[model samples]
Target: MNKIIYIGMDVHSSNFTLCSFEPGYGMSEDKIFGQVQFKDDLIKNTAKYICNLKSQRKDIDIVCGYEAGCLGYVPYRELTRSGINCKIIAPSTMAVQKGGKKLKK
Candidate 1:
């Protein structure tokens, strides 16, 4: 069976927090895969974790996105080379909650 897992990443200078969501009939269910910490190879470590996730599952496709800023296109290139679809989002255009909800820590 083919399944799609939506992944959102919170990226910082030295670490990245990766979370995964599965589409539900009435709502969306989510899981925190984990955080990747790196001193010099942030994108490489992140891509390794993503590939690890893919290898652990069968027939599941991943679509990952991160805000466009300091990181730039490095992430897009590495993730795409690993065969995962990636999106670099503009922070100004991303949707947010009406109330104070923490999207990233």
Candidate 2:
């Protein structure tokens, strides 16, 4: 059976903040990849990171996603070109928690 590594990205004009979640049935843990400086080949580097994870765990598949804004389709195109499954989520369609949105550690 293939396990999934779901990656969520908070992309900005100058950097990208990535977090990977591995669902352990009902006990999941999230691993933060931290902020990677934005550059011409940043998307390629992101793909390479995903590839590395795949290499370490052959039974896993990665799915990356980011909000649909600012940078536009470039990320989606690059990730797909690198053969990783990627999704672009609309901001309005996102489900918010009871407290709305908050920054907490």
Candidate 3:
């Protein structure tokens, strides 16, 4: 059986950027999925996208991370309810340097 892991997502009010990483498969190492834009509200669109990605990748474990922002907890709730594991990260967590901008401790 082929095992795939890790999915990174960059989300905004208008669109979502997705990148999938697989350890064992060379073919999936550099694969880039198309970006999806949502015309509806952020919460609804995020829920829809999570559901769709879960359905599409049933065999693989799907882990998603998005920056913590004004969108609130709706996205996290929706993703969890849809059975996709997600983490709400601070923008600073993705910073290249150790001390760029600090979020409240």
> Against the true structure, what is each candidate's TM-score?
0.75, 0.80, 0.61
Choose 1 or 3, whichever is better by lDDT.
1
What ranking of all candidate models by TM-score puts the best one first?
2, 1, 3
Model 3, poorest ten-residue lDDT window? 96-105
Tell me the TM-score of model 2. 0.80
What C-alpha lDDT does candidate 3 achieve relative to the native structure? 0.63
* Best-to-worst ranking by lDDT: 2, 1, 3
* Residue pair clashes in candidate 1: none
Cα lDDT tens digits, model 3, 45-95, are 656765676678678666677778866676788778767788888776664
Put down candidate 2 lDDT per residue, 13-98, tens digits, no spaces.
Answer: 77776777776776765445444444556787788877887898889888889988889999999899989999998887787768
**Which 10 successive residues of model 2 have the least lDDT summed?**
30-39
Across 11-99, the per-residue lDDT of candidate 1 in tens digits comes to: 77777777777665456544455554556677887788778888998888888898888878888898898787999888777666779
The C-alpha lDDT values of all candidates are 0.76, 0.78, 0.63
| Clashing pairs for predicted structure model 3, backbone only | none
The segments of candidate 2 whose C-alpha lies over 4 angstroms from its true place after superposition are 27-40, 102-105
Candidate number of the best TM-score: 2
